[model samples]
Target: MGYVPITPFRRTAEAVCVQRARVQSAPAPLPVVSKWDILSELTEARAAFGLSDRDISVLRALVSFHPGTDLGADPAKLVVFPSNASICTRLNGMPDSTMRRHLAALVASGLITRRDSPNGKRYMRRSRGTATAFGFDLSPLPRRFAEIAEAAEAQRSLQEEIAALRETLSLMRRDLLGLLESLPEECQDAALTLSEDTRRLLRRKAGLPELRQREAELSMALTHVPPAEVISTEEMSTNAAEYEQHYQSLKKESSDSEDDPSWYPMQSDIPGSENALAKKKAEAIPPRIALRTVMSACPSLNDYAEGPIRSWSDLVRTAEGLRPMMGICRASWEETKRHMGQIEAAIVMAAMLERFEEIKSPGAYMRGLSQKAARNGFSAMPMVLALLRREGTAQYSPGRAA
Candidate 1:
C-alpha cells in the first residue's frame, strides 16, 4: 500500500484549510447558485471590508476558472487549480509577483483558501476516473453569501444617506448666502463666518454627523435673526405730515416772504405741466440712503451696476441699465418715471432688486408698482424706512442733499 504525502502549511494557512474542510463537510443543504451572483455580492461588500480594486480583480479571475457557471451544482467541485500564467492572462496580463500578492490578500481576507498538492504544484489528482482539485478552494464564498449581501445593502444605504445630506447642505448654503446679503452689517458678518465654515465642511466632504451639526448651528443662527417689519399706512401719513412741517419751518427760516418769486415757483408758472411737478418732487424726495447702505439692503442690484455705486447717481445709472434687461419697455419705464419721478423710480427699482427671488417677473412687478404710484397709493418713503429697519438703523435720516 502507498502512503499519501502530507502538504506542509503555515499556521494561518492550516487554520483556513481546516475551516474550509469543516464548511465542506457540513450537512447543510446546498442551493442552486451561480458564480456571478457570488462575485456580485463580494464586489458590493468589498468597500465595507476595505478590499481594494486589485483584490476584487484577482477574485474575478479566480471565479472564472470554475468548469461551470453554477456554483452549487456540486459543492465538492468548488475548488479551482488555475496556474499563475492562466490567472495573469485572465487579469489583463498582471505580473506574476503582483498576482501572488493579490492571491495572498484573498487568502488573508478568508474569501479563498489554498489547497496545495504535496509538491506545491496546482493540479487535480485522478483516482478511479474521479478528479479532485488541489489549489484555490472557493467554498468560503457560498458560506458567506448571506453576510456579504447584508454588508452590501448596509453600504448602499450609507451612500444614499450621504447623498441626501449633500443635497440639503447645498440648499442651506444658497439660503445662507442670500440671507447674509440681506442682513444688517453686524449680523451679515456673523452669518458670513458661519457660511465660510459651512463651505469648508462641504469642500472636505465631511460625514453626515459633522454636516448635520453644522446645519443645525446655521439653522439656529437664522432663528435668532429678527423678522423685517412692514411700515403701516398710518406711519407713512404721520411721516409725510412731519416732513411737510419741517420743510415749511426750514423755508420760513430762509425767507420772510412765502410769495418770493425766486424762493417758491407758482403752480400757474408751469400749469398742467407734469414734468415740472415731477422735477420738483424728485428734488424734494431727498437723496436716498447711501449707495453702500442701499446695496447692502438690495445686493442683487450690484449685479447690474457697471462699477461700484459710490453715489446715488451710480445707483440710478445701474437701475437704468437694468431697466431694459428686466424687460421693462421704454414706455413702461417712462410711465413709472412720470408717476413716481426719477428718485422714487430708482428707489423702487432698488427695492424690487432686493425682492428679486420672490418676484418671478420683474417687468410685471414694476408695472404693478407704477400703477399704485399713479393712484397715489405707493410711496418710496415706506420702502426706504422698512429697509432702514432691517439694517437696525434707529435714526431714519434722509440722504445728504445733492
Candidate 2:
C-alpha cells in the first residue's frame, strides 16, 4: 500500500477539524433527506449558529453541486467536489477572495468539512461508476438536522411572542392617548408623564415584561380618576331642548342687528341666564373655526385620516376611524353620540385625539365626557378655544368676522 500525501490551501483550524471529525464519526441516526430540506432548517436557525447571510448563501451554492436531491444512503457520497470556479459562478460572480473567506466560514461553523486532494484541487475520481471524491462534504447537515429543526421552531415561537407583545403595546398607547385627551387639565400632567415613559419604552423596542409593567402603571392611573357624573335620559332631553332654544334666541337676536353688543349678554346683564349664556357661547363658535384649531393643535390626527381633511365632515370621518383604536368601546361611543349628537361627539374625539398624549385611559375619559354631555355640561367649545389660546393667537376671534 502506498501513502497518498494531501496539502490544503490554508491551514485548517483545530477546533473546526475536531468538530468535523466528531460529526463524521457520529452514526447517521437521521434519515437521508433532500438537501433543500436541510438548507431550509439552516436558514431559520442561522442566527443561533452565528451564521451571516453570506455564509448561508455560500452553503446554498455547496448544496447545489450535490448530484442527487437526497444526500445518498452512503455517508461517503455526501462529498461534493465542485471546483472553486463553479462555486464563484453559482454565487453570482462573487470575487474569488470573498468566496474563499465565506467557504472558510462554512468550514469553521462546522456546517461543512474540507476534503483536500494532494494538489488542493477539487475533483472526483470514478472507480467502477462510483465516486471516490475529495472536496466539501455536507454530512454534518444530516447529523445536525434534529438540532437545527428544534432551534428553528424555538426562533419561530419567539418571533410570534414578540409580534403579540407589539400589538398589545399599540393598543395600550392608543387607549392612553384617548384617556389623556378626555381628562381635565388639572389631572393631565401625570398622564403626560406616563405617556413620555411609554414612548421611551417603545423607542427602545422594549420586551414583553417592560410593556406589561407600563400597562399596569397606566391601568393604576385610570383607577384613580374620579368617576363621571351620570344623568337620566329625561334630564338630557330637557337640557338639549333648553340649549337649542337658547341658541335660537341668540341667533335671532344676532341677525336682527349685526352691531348688537348684546349678542352674548354678560352674566351681570342677564342674572338668570348665566347657564344659558355659557351654553350659547359653547355652541356659538363656527364648526370651521373649531376644525381649524383642532387640526393645527392635534396634527397627529392627520396620520389617522385616509385623505386630506379639507372639511369638518372629513375630520369627523377620521375621528370615527380612530375611535376604536383609542379603546373606546362601541357601547360607550354610541352613548356619547346619543347624548352629544354625532358632530359634537366627533369634535370631542378629535380633541381627545389631539390631547391623547396627556390622557391615561381614553375609554374611561370618553365615558366621563358622555355622562357630562348627558347633563348638557360637556362643551367642546371651551376645550377647542383653550387649545387655540395656548397657541398665543386665535384663528378666529369670537364676536368678530374673519
Candidate 3:
C-alpha cells in the first residue's frame, strides 16, 4: 500500500473545535455603569444632609421597592427622593445632625438638588431615561454644560410644538368627514363606508338613494303573480301552432285601426317631455367653494423661511400653494381657521404650562441627575474648587473654617 498520512482537513477540524470550545468557556464582559448605581450612592449620602441613617436607608428602600409611586408625570419617570422625615416615616427613624450635612455635601457635589415645596424641601433624583439617550462626555465641561442647557430649552419648545400639531391634525380630519356627511341621504351610507375619497365623491354626485332602498323598490316591482298557463316542452311546441292562429286574428284587427291617422302617435309627443327648458336648468353648476387650508404645521425656527416676506406672509404664500394641491374643500376652511386659532391658543397655553412645569421638568431633573452622577461617578468638588480655589496654581478644596 502507498504511504498513509493524516489529512490536513482532519487537523483543521480539530483546531476549529478547540477554538469554539475555548470561546464558549470564556466568561462574558462586565456590564457598563448604570443610573441605579449612581442613585444608590446618592441615597446613601442622604444622612450627610441632616437626615438620619435610618432615613437614608428608607429612601433607598422606597426607590428600590416602589419606583412607580415616586415617579409622577415625568417622561423620564424618575422617582423623587423623599425627605428625612418621610424617609423616617417610611423606614421608621428620626432626623440627625449629620444627615443634613451629608445632603449638603451631595448638593455641593451637584449630585442632587434640594427641591422646595409648599410643605417643605426634599431631595430629588432623575431616572436614566433622559440621560442615556444623550451620552455624557466630560472632556469639555464648560461646553458640555452650555450644550446641555440649550438642548434642554429645545426639548421644551419641541414638546409644545408636538402638542399643538396633534390638535390641528385632529381638526383637519374632522372637517374632512363633515363635508362627506352633507351629500344626499341616498349616498350618505356608502359615503360613510367609502375608503377611496374620489369614489365617495362620484357616488354622492350620482344622486342615487341609499343602495338598500333602490334594491327594495326593484324587488317590489319584480314581484311575481300566478302564471295564466303552464306546459311541458313538447306540449308548448304543439301549443305554438294554436297561438299563431290567435295572434293573426288580433293583428288583423290592429291593422284595420292603424288606417285611422288619429290612432297613431308621433315619437316626440310622450308623457315624459325632453325640452330646451330642462337643458338650461341642467347646465348650471354649483358655486366653487373657496377653501382656506391653513398650514397649521408650525415650521420650526430652523426651517422658518427667511426673506423680505419674512413674516407670516411667507408662511401664508406657502399655505396657499399647499392648499389647492391637497384638495381640501372650502366648506372646511372655517374649521381649518379654527384649528389654527386653537394652535395659537395652545402655544400661549404651553408657555403658561412651561412656567409651572419648569420646577418639575426632565431638564431640571436631569440637571440634578447629571450633577448626582458626576458627584458619584467622578469628583466635581475637586475640579470646581480647583477652578475657584487656587493653591499656587492648582486650586484645592475650600476647607471648612475651624
Residue 380's lDDT in candidate 1:
63
Q: Clashing residue pairs, candidate 1?
A: none
lDDT by residue (tens digit), candidate 1, 1-402: 022222234434366556655555456666666779888877878977668889999999998988788876787688898899999999989999999898888876777766767668888888887787778878778777787889989867876777666656556654554444345656765665565566556555467788679778878767654576323446544653432333333432332332333323345426458766655666476542444445655667877788878877787788898887765666667667766776678877887666555555565456556666767645664454444333332221122110
Candidate 1: list runs displaced more than 4 Å: 1-27, 182-184, 229-402
Whole-structure CA lDDT of model 1: 0.65
Model 3 residue 330 distance off true place after TM-score fit, in angstroms = 99
Candidate 2 wrong stretches, greater than 4 Å: 1-9, 16-20, 26-30, 127-130, 181-187, 196-402
lDDT of 3 by residue, 240-312 (tens): 2332232333433322321244323334324355533332332232111111111111222213234323433
RMSD to the true structure for each prediction, in A, is 14.6, 14.1, 36.8
Worst 10 residues of 1 by lDDT: 393-402
Give per-residue CA lDDT, model 2, range 60-99, as digits (tens). Answer: 9988987778864667678788888899999999998999
Candidate 3: Cα lDDT at 327 = 34
**lDDT minimum window of 10 residues, candidate 2:** 393-402
